[model samples]
Target: MRKTKWFTFRNFFHRSSLTSSMKPRPVNAYSFVPFSPVAMLDPTILTIGGVVLGIAIIERILERWGVIDLVDQFSKVMRFILPVTFYGALFYFFATFMF
Candidate 1:
């Protein structure tokens, strides 16, 4: 005797649902750490420095490639602006979150 296509499909879904329901539900994995302003200061500075360095490197690459005159000019402007922006943002985060 041949099983009908609909019967096989229905059985597949039913079996899957049964097995899924029998398995234990997953536990929540997320854990939060309490924030410490003093602990964060050094890492925050280092992160800002890293970000500035990365931007400078990318700008240098763009200048080397000579892709667009506008990008080269923008890169030059950003070299000074990016550090200031990152530093300002860091200050803002500390001010808002820590204080």
Candidate 2:
């Protein structure tokens, strides 16, 4: 009798030929350790964080300066553009790198 696709797939994961030693342990089996403060000071992360904080501060300053029209227009454009750009980049990355 021919096995179904599901049966074949299931059997692949549960093959008796695989020894217990070869099986990977569950994530919970490992103890968790918090990152040291020094290890967390990654330059790339700090640079990205600084850029975001700078943008926020600039936006606040623009708002305080009463450039409502310019700010609103820029915000509206960014609201639409950012998502499209983000999704386009994400799709491109997955299409090229993942598949």
Candidate 3:
């Protein structure tokens, strides 16, 4: 005997019936409309922002502390830096069009 699974979903009671049962009507429609830009932000943007900031900060701090000796080694970091700037530009295009 499974007891009919309790019928536990929120919508088991119809809205009109819910109105009668509750006396005062709770809500006419859904309350909150989320703001546009924040909603527009996709996962990739957040991930890139976090990763780029973290890497740049670490690189700066390392450079400041005199840890990386060879100035030529900065060439490797510059590779990543250029593409990050390009990614920023593409993201701007996305913001302009898609969002």
Q: What is the Cα-based TM-score of model 3?
A: 0.41
TM-score of each: 0.37, 0.41, 0.41
Poorly placed runs, candidate 2 (over 4 Å): 1-34, 77-99
lDDT of 1 by residue, 1-99 (tens): 955545477687566453442558889885475677575567666687787788778777877798678677877788788878877967867676743
1 or 2, greater by TM-score: 2
Which pairs clash in the backbone of model 3?
none
CA error at residue 82 for candidate 2, angstroms: 8.3
What lDDT is reached at residue 53 by model 1? 81
- State each model's CA lDDT, in order: 0.71, 0.62, 0.64
- The lDDT of model 1 is 0.71
Per-residue lDDT, model 3, residue 92, is 69
Best-fitting candidate, measured by lDDT? 1
Candidate 3 on 26-51: residue-level lDDT in tens?
76775374346664466666676677
lDDT of 1 at 96: 64
Question: If both were scored by lDDT, which would come out higher, candidate 1 or candidate 3?
Answer: 1
